[model samples]
Target: MDDAANPLRIPPQMSVYADKHNLFHLLQRMLTGLLIDQPEDPISYLVRLLQAADVPKIMLLGPPAVGKHSAAKKLSAELGAVHVTTDSLLEDQSELSAEARQYALTHQEIPAELLIQLIKRRLNSVDCVDKGWVMEGVPQTFLQALRLQQAGVIPQHVVMLEAPDDVLLERARGRLVDPLTADVYHQTFLWPADDAVAQRLEKRRDLPEEQRLADLQRYRREVTALTSAYQHVLRVVNSDQPITDVYQQVAAFVKTRRYYRTPRILLLGPPGSGKSHQARQLSEKYKMVDVSCGRLLRAAAADGSAVGDEVQPYLDGGTPVPDPLVLKVLDKRLSRLDCCSRGWILHGFPRDLEQVRSLQESQHRPNRVYFLEVTDDVCLERITLRATDPVTGERFHVVTRPAPNSEVHKRLRTRPEDGVDTVTQELRLYRKHTAALQSVYPDAVHIDADQDFHSVFEALESRLTAD
Candidate 1:
């Protein structure tokens, strides 16, 4: 048996019958010394203690919106570590050079060469030396991590933090990023104030469904692969626990390793309410997963197996898939990111009253639900903006069209079912179902989608900032 591959290697010396109570306290003592009568600055103490433990160059990875940045800031402040994130870099840029802007638009990752250069640049800075530096949102792949390692930048420890998918999606959905400052606000959890804050923050609306899902899928793949390659240096932690508890546990983990931060959100909304849109943007901005049930189910169905056969009917019929199947699919997809332990953005699934009930029954529920409440007329208008698929001839309201000669419009021109009446009827059904769905989850926040897309996003930003 390969001992390295064993689960025991992941977190050693834990018996099945170990005491559950005071578990965290036990971990804290063993990892970072007893917090009992500890110094006022626990973070600073932990950093010095960890250095004594011979751990340095920590990397933290997790889904976005799970408080990764906050945790990093708090930890850095405590340890006098230099904190670096993409948002900080973007802020310092005068204007994204043509190449940089192109990279942003295309969602091309920060290349390892560029990242390496940036690291060298940062490291040479007076502030970055002596004081340990904590890097966020770089080396998104195993190859990149390897490149850093070969460059003698190997982190002493790596940490991955994750929450349930729904929590991540909700967090993503409720999030508002101030475009000017790159400040984040969660609708019910972390609302911000100040007109300047409000004006600078912008809710993203340009992302399309396919792009959102693709980005999420890509993050799950790349991050997981990267982490696996550094199995020996990694330490995984679940952020699903309460913030205080998660904070304590993670502090302990980093006390022994290098790591990244991941935030999870559970997104909830009406049909075509742009929940998926929000999820993708958050994932890109935060470099996390958008755990979309629709995409997950479709992927499973595309496999053409027994389970896929069962899933095909629901998707093909334009009906909601069952919760059990949704869970099964989610379980499998999430397993792929077991190494990431980063937070994720959960979009789709948990629709209507039954789905909500199902989620509760499974004991996995979103931290929040960001409802995009549009009038029937507004929803109709938004849905009509969509066109048919070029290849399959399937009409969809969410997929992006190329332009006036958009692939979507071109496809609509040829599809037999692309008539105005068909679209109108589909919109009608969408409205009818969503109205009922609203009644089921009465607590869901209502964001007005009747305004211009940016205005709607402004309202969303306002709601989130208010929190």
Candidate 2:
């Protein structure tokens, strides 16, 4: 394209002798180029192209688990911008005035006055003012959006991640959180690798189904008003597909351009299916972060936070933590990192259909799900031979990695449930709960785990790289 025809290209004369009139002319030419053979709304396209040089101030609106945060982070990284979320801002109350912190601690929800003050401070900060930013979890209501505009914190674009109510609920249900790190995980989709970490995970108690539905209904009501108020710059994306696909759509809308998206992979299987091993290998090979929900949960339980306090009782009793609680823990962890920018391997989660629904609802659905298939006999054998270190919770195989001496063997412990009878019982439970996943995740790539490690790993490598 010629300089005048290229939206991103500026002619030398325009730069050296630019005046208000010349700048206007340049913008006019860029608009004409952007509009050429384009199907997008002209005004919206023009607005986005005009803001290309300025710091991006974007607002991401969506129900919980709709991947708004993920999209925001990805866009921020892509544009060398900052990613801001109200939740993160609130979590570190030390930055706020004493009165604001006190009020935030006492109230179930921060009042608009307090929120506005904090948000204004954040927007005026150096990072947001100098660089662009993708902001999430604020301006929840039409009034809030207007208030932000009144405070001179206007967004150039307002993007909404849209999904069905049923999908939202399922995603809400599968949410897991690690109270320690505030990482989020989906039960059927993404989890930690260690069982101990799984033990500390609890469903997001704050997002019960009824509450989620209510919030969703409220969002629908507010969105009607908000979208109408900001229709010129509003963009809506259907987020029911895989997260990467949804991100691509959002990115295109944001830049008024297109780019390739990285894939997020999820590994699923019963106990002893070797999902963790594969996740580690894949993470190393692809430079993807390995989020082991189980490890996060365990850390949370040990971390002595409120979430850990709640999880200890369940772990002590050997009972499963509620799905909602687990989701909450995972959510916290995911929020703290750059999962979208780096991509990730989700391991040891979504042991049931409810978890699968949660993954879908949350907009954190995986690009590909690998279900490691192993026979009951093989799983039982692996479980039966497993030994644990009481102090460290490390696992050892009696045959493969036995203690080096009698003194070391004396210190090793085996779970009472790892006995042959208990192992059989566990296999039956796995079959009862997880076997149906084969049908549920019809698109999942299945690999035989009963084979030697090299064979199984090779199959996985081939399938993953083929894409």
| Top candidate (TM-score) | 2
Off by over 4 Å in 1: 1-262, 304-306, 313-320, 338-340, 389-411, 414-445, 452-467
For residues 1-467, what per-residue lDDT tens digits would candidate 1 score against the true structure?
12323342222112111222324323434343323224577777566444443323556776655667766766667767787775455444443333344566677776676666556456435566456666765666777877765554655556677666567666666677877655566666666668678666666554554654565566677766776555545656776665667768767866753322223356654445677777776566445578888787888899765667888999888887877888766655543433124346677765555666665554234434566766655554455556656667565554344434455455563333444566567556555567665665566667775555567655543333121
Error of 2 at 170 (Å): 61
Work out the TM-score per prediction: 0.41, 0.42
Give a tens-digit lDDT track for model 2, residues 1-467: 11233244333233323322334434544554454426367776565545543677788888777767667877888988777876656655454655566665774566677788787777656677678788886788888877765655656677899988888777777888777655566787566777777888878766456777778888888987777555546778998887778888888777752122334678887777888888888777666778897886787799767877787788888888888778867655543324544456888677777877776666455767788899877887788888887766778788777766776677888788778887677667667877566666787898889988889888886565223
Best candidate per lDDT, number? 2
The C-alpha RMSD of each candidate to the native structure, in angstroms, is: 18.1, 27.0
In Å, residue 130's CA in model 1 sits off its true spot by 16
lDDT against true structure, model 1: 0.58
187 Cα displacement, candidate 2 (Å) = 62
Error of 1 at 403 (Å): 4.8
